[model samples]
Target: MSAYPTDRQPTHTPVMLSEVLALLNVRRGGVYIDATVGLGGHAAAILEASAPDGRLLGLDADAQALAAARRRLEPFGERCRLEQAWLDHCAAAAARHGFSAVDGVLCDLGVSSLQLDDPQRGFSFQQDGPLDMRLGDAAEQTAADVVNYYEEADLADVIYRLGEERRSRRIARAIVERRPLETTGELAQIVQSAVGRGPRRRIHPATHVFRALRLEVNRELERLSGFLASARGLLAAGGRLVAIAFHSLEDRIVKRFIRAAGSGDDAGFRSLSKKVIRPSADEIQRNPRARSARLRAAEAV
Candidate 1:
C-alpha cells in the first residue's frame, strides 16, 4: 500500500459536495453508500451532515485510496465502514454490511485526484510515470499493454470511441511506429508530435489519448454500466440515487439511465431534476476540477 504522510490530507476536494448531499437528501440515521469513495472526502462530509447515528458504507477500487479513507473517517468510529471494492460490487457489499434498501447511493464516476496526482499510477500525461493506469491493483492489462500490444486499427477505435478524439487514426499510427512504449511521458510525446500543437488549445493534445488508455485499462465504462443496472434495486422506496460524472461520455450514461428509469409507468424511479445540476461558479473558482462535473439524480418509486 502507498503510504501517505499522516500530517497531510488528501488534496481531492469532493466535487459538488453540497449538491450531492442535497440530491441524496442525507438525513440523520440514514444508511448511505459512497460507491466511489476516494479518500473519503464525500463520505466524511456525509457522515458529519448525517450526524449522530447515520451509517455509511464506503467502497473504492484503489487500496491506497481506502487507506487514506480509513484514516480520514476513523474519527467517525463505527458510523463509517470502508471497503476496498469496485463500483460494480457495491450491491453485494451493501447487502453484506446490512445496508440493503439504502436510503441513498452516490456514485462519483471517473478518475480521482489521488490517482492522477500520483505519477507512479500514470493516470496523467503531465507527470512522467510508468504506463500503468489500472485504477485497481488487480487489472489484468495496463496502459502499457494497450499502447504496445493493440493493433493500430484497434487502438484508433479505442481512442476514437472512448476519448472522442477526431485525430485518433493519426495518433494510433504514431504510437505503433514508436512501439514498446514503456512510460507515460514517452506516449504523451508521441501523441503530441502526431497531433501537433494547435493555436489557443485549452488543454494538452495528449490529454484525451491518456484518458482513453486509462478508461480501457480500468474497464471503467463496463463497471459503470453494471453499477447503474444494480444501484436502483439497492435503494428503498422514495430513496434517491445521485451520480456525478466528469466527462461527456459518463454524463451521457447517467442522463440516459435516469431518463430510461423514469420513462415508463412501471419504471422504478422518477426524475428529481429535468436538467443536470452543475457546480456553482464560486465552487469552481475554489476547485477548478469542479468545472466539468455534471450531476443527475432520481428517486426510487
Candidate 2:
C-alpha cells in the first residue's frame, strides 16, 4: 500500500527503517536530523522512539518531496521540522531554525521511491519520459542537457567514470550521432540499439548510465563529502551519527569518512561500528529495496 501513484510504481521503502532507530540510540529530549529525508518515514519513526520532548528535523532538496514529508510528519505537530535543503548545509539550516548541536544524525543516502516511480521525472530507464533528472529546484542541467550539450569526449568521460560502462566510447559515439534524445525511454532505446543483440536481460544495459546521470545531476558525491564533515560540526559531545548508503559509490565514501573521523589526528570520536550492518532476511523480503543498504555509525567524544 505505497502512497505514491500507481504509474510511478513505488520504488522507495525506507531501507533499514528499523535499524535506523536502533543505531541512533534515540531518547526523550534528544534532537536528530534525517538528512536526505525523502519521504519522512524513517524520521517519523526516529521521532516516536525519541519522544516526549524529542524533535526531528527532516531535510531534502525536492520541494515536492518536502511537501509530501510535511503531510507524513504532521501528526507529530511541532516536533518535526521539514525543510528543502541539502545535508551539507546542516549548520546554517540549524541556525535558521533556532536549533544547534543535535544529539544524533541520520542520513539515508538513497533516492526516493517517488522519483523512480514517476516516469515524468525521468530517473528510470524503464519508462519513456523526458530526460530531466534534476532533484532540487536549482538544477542547472537536465539529463537531456548533459547529453545534448557535452562533447562526445566529455560524454564518454561521464559515462565511463560515473557509470563504469566499459564501452563508454562506443556509447558516447552512438549518443552523439543520435543527438537530442528526447525522453528516458528514447535514450534507453538509443543505448539498447548501440549495445546490439544480447541476452534477454542482464540488469538493463543502461543501468549504469542512468545511475551516473542521476548522481551527476544531484551532485550527490560532493554533497555527501561535505555533509560528513558538516555533520561532525553539528553534533553535541557524545552524539552519534548513522548513515545508510545504497551502492558501492556511496558506501565507499561513507566508509572512508567514518574511518577517518573515528581515528582523527586528535581522536575526536569513537567508532561505534567497526563493520557495516545489513538488513535481515525478513526485512529484505518485506522490502526488496533494502537489499543493497549498508549501515554505518560513529560517535563524537
Candidate 3:
C-alpha cells in the first residue's frame, strides 16, 4: 500500500478486486502473470495474496507505467518480475525468464489511470496536452499526426465506429476545417464548439473520441486478440485467466473469447466466471473510475 507521487499522477484505478482475486485462485508456489500491469494496483494485491513462494510476472507496454508498478511492487523483492512489452507478446516474454507454465494470467483491459492522468500522453480530453497516445515507447502514429493528416472520411469513421459519436460527421468536418489540431485542448474545443456546448453530461463528449484515437494509435483490439490466443497456449492445466474490461466492446470480446475457449472437443479453456462481475457500489463510490469495470475469468482445460 505504498503510493508515491511522481511528476504525473496515475489516474488508473484497478477495478473489481474481490472478483479478480477469487477468479485467480492463487496458490502457493504457483506462477502468475499480470498481463496488463499498470501502476501495480491489481498486481500488488495479487502478490500479497499469493504470498511466500508464489511468483508474479507483471508486464506492461508503457515504460512509465512499468516504472510506477516497479516502485509500488518494490517491497515484494524477488517474488515479482516486471517486464516492459506489449501484452500480445507477453507470453513469450514471460517464458524468457523461465515461467513456461503459469498458473494464472490477469489482464485489465482499460488504459491505466497513469496514461489518462499524464497530460502529455493525450489519453484525456479533460486536460490540455500533446496529442501523443502511444502505449509503449514506440514512436509510431500519434493522435496529433492522425488529427493533422487523416482525411475527413477516415477521421469521421474513426470517431463514428470507434467512439460511437452520433455527430461524428459534423465533428469530423469541424476538425478538418480547423486544418491542424496541435493539442488535446484544441481538439476538445473544436468538438465542443461543433456540438454546441451544452450542460455537462455524465461524461465529456470528447471522451470517446480520445478513446478511439488511443485505440487506433496503440492497435489495442488487434493486440488483445493476439494476447488471448497466446494466453491460452501459455497457461498450464487448471490455470486461470482473469480479465477486467472497462467497456461494452471489450466485455463482449472477453465474453466471446471465453465461450470459444470453453467449447468442447477442441476447447482451450473452461469457464470460471460464468457471468461478468462488476464492482460493488461502495467500490464505485470510493473510486469513480471503477464504475464501468467488468471482470470475467476462465480456466485452462
Candidate 4:
C-alpha cells in the first residue's frame, strides 16, 4: 500500500519504519520534527500514526528533495510544515515553526537514496556523473573540488579517517597522479586501479573513497555534532529523540552522546534502546538500503 510508484519506490524506502514509529511513540496531538525528512516517507507515517491533531516540521537541505517532500505531505495540509535547511539548524527551525520542545524528534543521518540514485549528485560510484557531491546549495565545496585540489597528505587523511580505508595513502597517491579528474567514473577507476579488486571483495573498491568525498563536501560530521549538541534542549520532558545512522562513525557519535547524557548524577536523559536497533533480515530483503542502518533513541528527563 505504498503511495509511491513501483519504479520510484525502491529509491526511497524509509528504513526500519516500524522501529522508528515504536521508538518515537507517536501519539495524537503530539508535535514532531523530522530533521532529515527526505521525500516525506517517515513524515507521512508519523502523521498517520498521530492522526488528526499531530503536527510535523520536516527539514532538508536539498531543495529538490524538500519540494518532493512538500508534495508528498500536502494531503496533511497545515499539520505538516516543510523547510529547506540542514539538520544542524533543527532547533532554530523548530522554534520558528512553534515546535519548540516537541513530543519527538528524528534525525536520519547520511545520504538519502534520492541523492544516490540521481547520478548528477555524484554520491555513488556505480553511476557516472559530474564529481559534484554537494548535498545542497548550502555546501561550499564539491567532490570535484576536493579531488582536484586537496594536497595528497590531506586527501589521504580524509580517506583514512572519514572513509575508514586502510589503503588511503595508496588511493590518494593514485588520485594525485591523475589530477583534474572531472567525473565519478574517472575517480572510481583511479581508486579501483590503485586498490585492486580483491577476490573476496563484496563491495566496489571505490566505495570508501566516494563516501569520504561526500562526507567532506557536505561537512556531515561537523553538522551532526552541532545537531546532537542542540537536540536535547529542544525536547520537552519525556520527549524522545531518535537518530538513525548509516555508518560506524555516525553511530559512534550518537552512541556516545546518548551514553553521556544518561550517565551523570544530574542525568537529564534516559536510554530508550539498551542496544542499537538494526534492520531485521526481512527489512533488509525488502529494502537493501536498510542493511547498514542503526537506530539509537533516548528520552529527556
| lDDT agreement with native, every candidate | 0.90, 0.82, 0.84, 0.89
- Tell me the TM-score of each prediction against the true structure: 0.97, 0.93, 0.93, 0.96
Model 2 ranges with Cα > 4 A deviation: 1-12
User: Model 1, which residues run further than 4 Å from truth?
Assistant: 1-7
Query: For residues 1-301, what per-residue lDDT tens digits would candidate 3 score against the true structure?
Result: 1223666545456788777878888777778999999989888888888888789999999888898888889999999999998979887898797887788999998677777776777778888888888888773788888888998999999988778788899999999999778889999999888887667676777888888888778888778888998988888998999988888877888899999889979998998777788889899899988888888889998
Candidate 4's TM-score reads 0.96
Task: Residues 1-301, candidate 4: write the lDDT tens digits.
Answer: 0123435633378989999999899999899999999989899999999999999999999886787788789999989998989889888888888888888999887777777787887888898989988877889998989988999999999999999999999999999999999989999999999999999999998999988998899899989989988888898999999999999999999999999989979776899989999999999998989999999999999
List, residue by residue over 94-166, the lDDT tens digit for candidate 1. Answer: 8889888889999998877888887888888889889998888888899999999999999999999999999
Model 1: how far is 171 from its true place, Å?
0.5
Model 4 alpha-carbon drift over 4 Å, by segment: 1-11
Candidate 4 global lDDT: 0.89
Which candidate model has the greater lDDT, 1 or 4?
1
**Per-residue lDDT for 184 in model 2?**
89
- Per-residue alpha-carbon lDDT of model 2 for 104-150, expressed as tens digits? 98888857777777778888998778898888877778899888889
Candidate 3 yields a Cα-based lDDT of: 0.84
